[model samples]
Target chain A: MTAVSIDSAPKTAARRRERLASGRTYISAALIFIWCLIPFYWMIVTAFRDVGYTFDSTPFFTHVTWDNFNTVFSESLGNHFGRNLLNSLFVAGVTTVVALLFGVFAAYALSRLEFRFKFLVLGFVLGASMFPGVALVTPLFQLFTNIGWYGTYQALIIPNISFVLPLTVYTLTSFFREMPWELEESARIDGCTQGQAFRKVIMPLAAPAVFTTAILAFIASWNEFLIASQLSNDQTKTVTVAIAYFAGAQAHQEPYTAVMAAGTVVTIPLVILVLIFQRKIVAGLTAGAVK
Target chain B: MSTLAQPKRAPETPSPKTKKVQKEVGQDRAATSQGRWAFWLISPALVLLAVVIVYPVVNAIIMAFQKDQGLDPVTKVFVQGGPAGFDNFVHWLAQQCGSAACAPGTLGAQFWSAVGTTFFFTVVTVVLETVLGFWMAVIMARTFRGRSALRAAVLVPWAIPTAVTAKLWFFIFAFDGIANKLFGTAILWTGSEWPARWAIIISDVWKTTPFMALLILAGLQIIPAEVYEAAKVDGASAWQRFTQITLPLVKPALMVAVLFRVLDALRMYDLPAIMTQGSNGTTTLSILVVDQIRQGFNSAAALSTITFLIIFLVAFIFVRFLGANAVASATPKTTKGQEK
Candidate 1:
């Protein structure tokens, strides 16, 4: 009993020392968490507060109301803001669907099949992904204007698809490569044709990846600002562009409340997506960047 | 169903006549068809890519050499003039270097400043992001209660639109905003030079640090725990273990992540444009290109060509010096002969 107690006393002392070391780690983690979350919290706080209370010296949430949100929907400018939100949704949605459609086949081929100059092709796609959107802006502006596609949704959507397609291919290819080869082989042996095996067996397995890719593609297209700013007029302006040009009820006052409310509106969908599919999003994000 | 089932039985009970034919051509046919199928499957993407990306890029190259006559009034298409033979390029260089063709205090001068700003932004933000991201990644990689929640919180900023982030930051740095209250100084962030630049940097760091951390975390995850344990057994300190083991192992992923960020940073447009409208000496290469597009098309094309070349060169260097497959680590090399 004396020996065991002696051993226990030393063990307890060591644990205490270890805990002291770990204490810093926890504190830093908490600080990181707070740093990450404060901006978002600020946005939400600003969204609920009245326009009059936006510039108070005190930085606490007080007299919170849905009035700013109401203002975003009620006023004439709010209608425009509302339309911009719709435009953003449509543009982002179409970009996601179209890119994924093109990406799946290419990703599948790159990941699974052997062909001539395969690395070269993959290299080319990778290069294109890094193609500066700004570099393309002038040429696209000229082309779109010439084709009478300027100030149109298709104008914005087309450019977005081209830029984001490479990302989709890279991310999805990595995902497709991770799928077991035998799944397809067994499906083939079990009286399934190559096409049938892919569609029925492989695709179901790839659904989660596809969904992750979709969310990423969607978020990217949603976040597009430079091209959307150039391509769209009032009717087709995206939420990002709209937010940039957002005005108050009066010209002199900056519509901080309405803008915050609108900002919150735009942010909510993305937050929801991240919360629901955080795991998949992380996987999708790290897929190409890390092994 | 019967047709499919019939094929399965036929293959099993292959006739003698067919067996000879199968042996002669079946393997060759399957190989050729597989290649053909692969080509066919990938062609749609290749075609779409060529039409959209390749065509425009080629067009821009050509346009850079042509005279910058504004768009036609009737057709709205850019009207091309006689080949100027490096006139635009020379003019652009003059703006940056103060040549005869282009003078100081002009658009070209502005372009030079933007380039400098871009260089500054890229270096500063990339450094901050890498360091902070590494710290955040270390935190994220730790297994604990609510680790998943922490990761989600970190990604919230990444998911938010850049423009929204810009606006959010703009408000947060306003005269009466939280930044002033927190710092106890009412500096005009957006209306000034260094403060404005800092605002952009702060927002960018907040927005993209998650991406850096996520990429680094992936690298960290691949590092087996046994290496650390082995080092511990050898009486290595935490600092020593980290420097020797973690840093070396994490280099490739870090290289890739930094390369990606550097490229993206060089093309920065949205944050500065939305936050400060490229005012107060915060103009970047992209905003400059867009600005020049308003003044003259050919000049804008020239500037864009320069931007593309810089990006291309950086990519080329990365690929040439770094192992070409560094970024391709995402996919296993499953093909027959393409293995590194």
Candidate 2:
């Protein structure tokens, strides 16, 4: 009985040491996690806390309430805010699909086809990608105005296409170049039309890359504040612009919590998108700006 | 940030009918046709760029040379003006008795000062970010428990949407907000000029320092352990190894990181727009351009061109000094090399 107890006790001691080491890692991780979460935490807390409590200069603990969120959901501001979110989603969704079509086809051609002036075209597009987007905003506003497309989806859609296309094409082109050729050739030999082969074979292989491209394009379109602000006057304002306008038009910044609540609303899909495809996204992001 | 972007190594997809292309080439040595099927395929994108990017950019350049005759850009009608060559330049130079917003030396009152402030903000933020990013990267690159968590933790700030981030910072820096509470009394973080610039810079740094680290980490992952081991055996201090060894080896990625951050910083819009709304000395080139356009000035086109030139010059200096290689050789070629 003593022997068994001694053996079990030593095992427990070793387990205790292991537990201590793990505890250290957990505590360190928790600390880092808290630091990471502070902004998000404060955002949520401020979003929920009453306006009076938000400004309370007390050194410590404040009780929470969902008054702001409740107010947001039960008001005209909430209704407009919700509509704008939908507008951003719809605009972003359409923009992504269109950008993919342009970027992917261009990538396919650049990657596979032997064309004259190819290098010049490549250089021009790549150079254009680096051109400050802000510089183009003025000209675009003019162009959109000229086309009688002001305050419309056509205004945001076309420019969004241009902005996201270079990156999309650049990325997809590189991804397409890296793909093995045999799958394409074999399918070609098996009587698959180039389009069908692409649709069936190349596209499936490129699906992961496509997802990365689409997600980014969507996010860029959604977060686009400058263009959305300038071009969309009322009917077509995106959520970001709408929220900013909402903040600005306030008698005071009365909707501080509401603005953040709106941000939380806008952030949901993005956070989900980031979390779900974190690995693919990590590679895309790290490598994206490099090229 | 990964959600924001990823490298698309231009797909080098081999032609499916290379034999056909080769045969067609040899058969038609005196080719008269406009390129090939590939050109046709890429034309839609080519056309989009041609109109949206190429046409506007080329137009901006032409407009810069032409006199700004207070005309409608869309209608091309001179509502209140005539061609006055070098007058716009002189006006911008503040040589022709202009307002303080167009003043020569003092910042808060001149166009030249606005330009200076833009450069100043870009330099300070980029320099600070690089230093902080490198420090964070060095910590991350070391082998330790919870490294992945640490990496992800750093990435969270970067992943938050810019509008959300800007607004969050706005709240934090708001009068009677957390910033004021912490500093005691309501500090005007954004309402004024220099304070507003600082506030914008602070918010920008918080959001983007992680981006700088991620880029540098890509560089750090490529450094072979043997080099570090050798340095350690030679009893090199951390600073020596960092300066003499790490910096030199990772110079390429570092440059790319800096170049990207600089170009990005030059186009400061969102943070400043929200933080100060172009008030005070925080009026950047972008905000200035936006204002001119919003004012319905034909000169706005000319102004955008000038901004483009400034941005291009900055980009050129970065490219020239940084080796201009987009293909990051600092990325270790093998999977095993990813282990730090």
Question: Which tens-of-lDDT digit does each residue in A5-114 have in candidate 1?
Answer: 55787888977987875786788788889988898888888998978888764556887899888777765654577788889899999999989999999898888775
Top-TM-score candidate index: 1
DockQ class, candidate 2: acceptable
Which residue pairs come into collision in candidate 1?
Answer: none
RMSD of each: 4.9, 8.5
Task: At residue A61, give the lDDT of candidate 2.
Answer: 41
The TM-score of the first chain in every model comes to: 0.94, 0.79
Q: Among all windows of ten consecutive residues in candidate 2 chain B, which has the lowest summed lDDT?
A: B1-10
Q: Tell me the interface RMSD of every candidate, in Å.
A: 3.6, 6.7
Tell me the TM-score of model 2: 0.81
Worst 10 residues of 1 chain A by lDDT: A1-10
> What DockQ would you assign to candidate 2?
0.31
